[model samples]
Target: MRRSRAALMAVVLATTASGTAAVTADAAPASATRATACPTGWGSLAEARAAATTVPVRDVGTGRHACFDRLVVHVPGASAASLGHRVRYVDRLRQDGSGRTIAVGGGAVLEIRVAAPGYRPETGAPTYPGRAGRPLPGVDLTGYSAFRNTRYAGSFEGETQFGLGVRARLPFRVLVLDGRVVVDVAHSWGAAR
Candidate 1:
C-alpha cells in the first residue's frame, strides 16, 4: 500500500492508493499518526474514548483499500465524543426510528450506531438525509470484493444507525477522526495459523 498525506480543514488524510487506504487528518500530527491494527484474524469488538461534540452528520462516503473497505460518515461539527460508535454483527438490521427489518445482500450484517445527531437541531432537519430502507445508495460498490452495500437504518434520539453488508462476517474496526467517523471491514477472515 502506497501512503500519502494531505491536510483537510484541521485534519490530515493519509491515503494509500492501488492497495489503497483511507486517511483523515486533524490538528495533532501525532494523533493522526495513530494506527489501528485491522489485519486479518483480529477481533471485531472495539471501544475507545469518545470524542466530545454534538455535530450532526452531513455526508457519507466510502473507499476501497488494500486491506479493507471503508465507510466514512462526515459530521461537520463533530468532536470525538460525537463520533463514538457501537458496531456489532447482528442477525438483521432494524430502522432506527421505525424498527423495521432491513434486508442487505451479504452473509453478515455489521450494525453501526454512532453517538451523534444526523439532523439540524432547531428544525430537526435530516443532516444525512436518506431513504427509509436504504439511505445514501450512491455509495456504490461496483467492483469491491468484500463490501456488498452500505445501508442507512435511521437516526433517532441523538444517535444515527447504519449497516454494512459484507461478503461474509469478518473482522472490522471503527475510528473517530476529527469530524468523521470511519468503519473499516477486512477483506478476508484469514486462515488458521
Candidate 2:
C-alpha cells in the first residue's frame, strides 16, 4: 500500500510539471524579445518620455525649468516614514558623466551596483537610437554599495531628476532635462520581485 501511494504521488508531481511546461510553451509565442537600438540622443523630450515606457535608455536635454514644478525622484525605498533615515542614496554632483563629486543635495554616494552579499558594479548597456520596437536591456544595480547611503548615479545630461543614477537590476529609462532626472522603471530582469 505504501509503495503504491508513493508511486501515485510521483505521477501527480510529474503531471503538474508537464502541465506548467505546456502552459509556458503556449504563452511563449505571444511576444518576442525585440532588441532596442536607441540613438546617442533622442530628438525631443516628448519622444524620450514615450521611449521610457518601452525600454532602457540614457539621454540629456535643456529647457526652462517648469515654472511651478521642480522635478525630484527620491531614493528607492525611501518614504515619508523613513525621512532622514540612512537609506542608500544617490544625487547629482558636478557635471554629467564627469566622475566629479560634489554635494548637490542631501544624500550619500552610490558605490556598489547591487545590494546583495556579493555584488559588483556593472556598466550601462549599449544603446542605439532610431531603432523602433526593440527592447532596452535593464540596468542591474541590486547589490551595489553606496557611499554614505548615496545610491544615486550621475545625471544623464545635467538634468536634475534626483535619485536618477546608475542602478542595479532595475530596468529603467532615463530622461534628463535642465536639472531633473526622469527615471522610468521596467520590470527587473535579475532582481527579486
Give the candidate number with the greatest TM-score.
Answer: 1
Across residues 133-154, which tens digit of lDDT does each residue of candidate 1 receive?
7746568787676788778888
Native-to-model Cα distance after best TM-score fit, residue 139 in candidate 1, in Å: 0.3
lDDT tens digits by residue: candidate 2, 1-193:
4664465456446533322111122222222353222223211122222112112223221111101001123223322222221112343333235555544222222221211101111443332221111111232233322101122333242122223232232333343332223333322332222
Candidate 1 residues lying further than 4 Å off, grouped into runs, are 1-13, 16-41, 46-52, 191-193
Q: For model 2, what is the alpha-carbon lDDT of residue 150?
A: 23
Residue 14, candidate 1: C-alpha displacement in angstroms: 2.9
Off by over 4 Å in 2: 1-99, 102-169, 174-182, 190-193
RMSD for each of the candidates: 7.8, 19.8
Query: In each prediction, how many residue pairs overlap at the backbone (N, C-alpha, C within less than 3 A)?
Result: 10, 46
Measured by C-alpha RMSD in angstroms, how accurate is candidate 1?
7.8
lDDT of 1: 0.69
